[model samples]
Target: MKKGILILAGIFAMTFVSCKEDAAKKVKEENVEMAEGRDAKNTDFPVMSFAKTEHDFGTINEGDVVEHKFEFTNTGKAPLVIVSAKGSCGCTVPQWPKDPIAPGAKGEMLVKFNSSGKPNQQTKQVTITANTETGKEIIKIKASVTPKAKPVSGTPVSK
Candidate 1:
């Protein structure tokens, strides 16, 4: 009777452990699915194809503000949704679409850079979070900021 009771208890413990592992695995799978979204398994997830990922503004004077429009297209079967866009620094601002772009539709990202205190060969990055498979993308802008030019007095310099 003692042997039978010990065997029964061991079997119950084994079953409970197996069930707990299975439950954990199920929860992990569900979490993955939730993080990836329902279309995660789809091969044709939204593709963010930028016409140009980087822009060169050449040389700009200090305190100058410049703008650029980055064109892009959704080349995937799924709709492209730009979740958020942020600049690398406060002086750089990015504007992106707030709506979902249909497949093959065109869109643009407007980025503005304020070179007030920025100097030299400055590279600004705009990180975009989107519904694409990779989930994030980056666009860059380069500019060389020159010092503010000193104004010349109208009066001629006396030698």
Candidate 2:
């Protein structure tokens, strides 16, 4: 009776394995079809060409708020649509155009950085999601921040 039970369990496991393989093959076929479709439309993808990929603020004081505009041109056959732009941290913010940019047209994204608590040399990145080729683009901003000086301990203040 024990041998018969073991054989039944083995048969069940084999059936499950066969079903999993069949499902995997179906999924693989679907993925291949999707890839083929994407390849066909690859030629129509928009291209985002930026004038400068990185901006340097040189030197800035702490607690200062600064902004920079990044210029770009859609140098592709299709219209360029920027879906979203995200900064690396809360102190960094980005603003981008919501409308679609036509081929050969130009656009700009504004990045704002607040050096309130940030000190020393800092670099931040902005990730832009768009319908352009590669689907995502990255831009950078760097700055050398001069921190504020602290007062001496137990020192008398002079008015």
Candidate 3:
């Protein structure tokens, strides 16, 4: 009777330990699955696409003010909001639309390049910050300027 009782007690203890371990593993797996689901739903913004990424002014005369329009469309499921537009240098200025663009909607950014003090081959970059997944978009402008000819000096010479 003593032997039978000891064997029975040992079997009961082993069974209880196995059941507890299985329950703990199941809870851990569930927690991990829930965390993954939450991460997938936490996107801040959507994606955007630009119609034209680069602009070439070709050859611009000195002291000329040139402007170009950069067009873009919202290609994602959320609304696109442009926070600000910044130029690489003071000679270049950028302006963005104030209103938010819905999905599949279009918008434009106006950029002006002042060539007053700029000369030779110049390249300028404009950074646009918006409520998009990528956060910032970059646009580039390039121009070549020809300097004005110097005035001729008056001189008398005998041939």
- Clashes per model (N, Cα, C within 3 A): 0, 0, 0
Q: Write the per-residue lDDT of candidate 2 for residues 44-100, one digit (tens) a residue.
A: 878999999999999999999999999999999999999999999998999999999
Clashing pairs in 3: none
Task: Give per-model TM-scores.
Answer: 0.70, 0.80, 0.69
lDDT of 3 by residue, 1-159 (tens): 999999999999988777555556557877889999997897756556888899999999989999999998888888888899899999999999898899888888899999987879999999989878778989999999877665667865559
- Reference-based TM-score, model 3: 0.69
Q: By lDDT, who's the top model here?
A: 2
**lDDT (C-alpha) at residue 49 in model 1:** 95
User: What's the CA error at residue 36 for candidate 1, in Å?
Assistant: 11
Positional deviation of residue 133's Cα in model 1 after best superposition, in angstroms: 0.2
Score candidate 3 by lDDT.
Answer: 0.87
C-alpha local distance difference test of each model = 0.93, 0.94, 0.87
Error of 1 at 43 (Å): 1.3
Off by over 4 Å in 3: 1-37, 150-159
Q: Tell me which of candidates 1 and 2 scores higher on TM-score.
A: 2
Q: Which one is best on TM-score?
A: 2
TM-score of 2: 0.80
